[model samples]
Target: MNFDASLWLIFILIGLATTLPRASFIVLGSRVALPLVLQRALRYAPAAALAAIVAPDVLVAGGQVEILNPKLAAAGVAVATASLWRNPWLPFIAGMGALHAVRYLSGS
Candidate 1:
């Protein structure tokens, strides 16, 4: 492999971008206060991000819409199994098993 100056520059830019916001928070913490509305909205950021990441996978099938997917079904099963069995690992195993079972049965 060869080292490229452009690649290094790109990496440097990415690192700077990632660090600058965090550094800004530390450097300007006392000088600034997050707006109340913004803070409230920020509180939902994780949920929004999780939905953004999982919603598509759990809702989409083929090129069309499918509100009920194997993953979603498996999640339901996982939640139920977890609650009933009270085992953390069982949920994961059951979820995967349910998803695979659906896939196998559906032949998709």
Candidate 2:
């Protein structure tokens, strides 16, 4: 497939935008150390990012809380699996399996 010139430019711009901040940290971190408070706070970034990514998908659908969302059910299964098995892969497998099982059973 042939990509248009504008599409190529957009792709390049997006790559640069994403790469620049990460590269800047690596380049500048050697010259300066971030404050201790900021360093501690940054530790939460992954959990915060994960919650930001997941909360909406689990709790909202069609711009509202979907009580019957299969995702919610699957998330519960995943959480339970994670708590019980304490394995990273098991939660993901359980979540996807629960999601598919719910969808198949409900025919939706």
Candidate 3:
């Protein structure tokens, strides 16, 4: 398949847009230290980002909050597993197991 010039230009622009900001941080971080408050705050960034990415998909279905969904049940199980076990892998295993169990029981 052949691509047109505009498509290639758009792809190049998107690649640069995605790469530049993150690259800038790494390049600049070697010389400049982040503020103490900012560094402390940034510690929560990964969890916050993970929640942001995962919450909607887990909670929402057909444009509504799906209280009875298997995903919701699985999320609860995952959280509980993480809290109790404090193991990263346990949460994932429990969540997937819960999801499959719910789906199988519900026949969906």
Give the poorly placed runs of model 1, Cα more than 4 Å off.
1-24, 79-88
Over 1-108, each residue of candidate 1 has an lDDT whose tens digit, in order, gives 997789989999999977996697698878888788988987897899887997777767796777667877887887799889977799999899999999888888
Q: How close is candidate 2 to the true structure, as a TM-score?
A: 0.67
TM-score of 3: 0.64
Q: Each model's TM-score, in the order given?
A: 0.62, 0.67, 0.64
How high is the CA lDDT of each candidate model? 0.84, 0.90, 0.91
Write model 3 residue lDDT over 1-108, tens digit each, in one string: 887789989999999987986787697877877699988997898899999999999999889998999999999999899889967799999999999999999999
Model 2 misplaced stretches (Cα beyond 4 Å) = 1-31, 86-88
Q: How many residue pairs clash in each candidate?
A: 0, 0, 0
Model 2: per-residue Cα lDDT over 1-104, one tens digit each: 98777998999999997898678769787787779998899899889999999989998978998988899999999989988996779998889999999999
Q: TM-score winner between 1 and 2, please give it.
A: 2
Q: Which residue pairs show backbone clashes in model 1?
A: none
RMSD to the native, candidate 2? Answer: 3.6
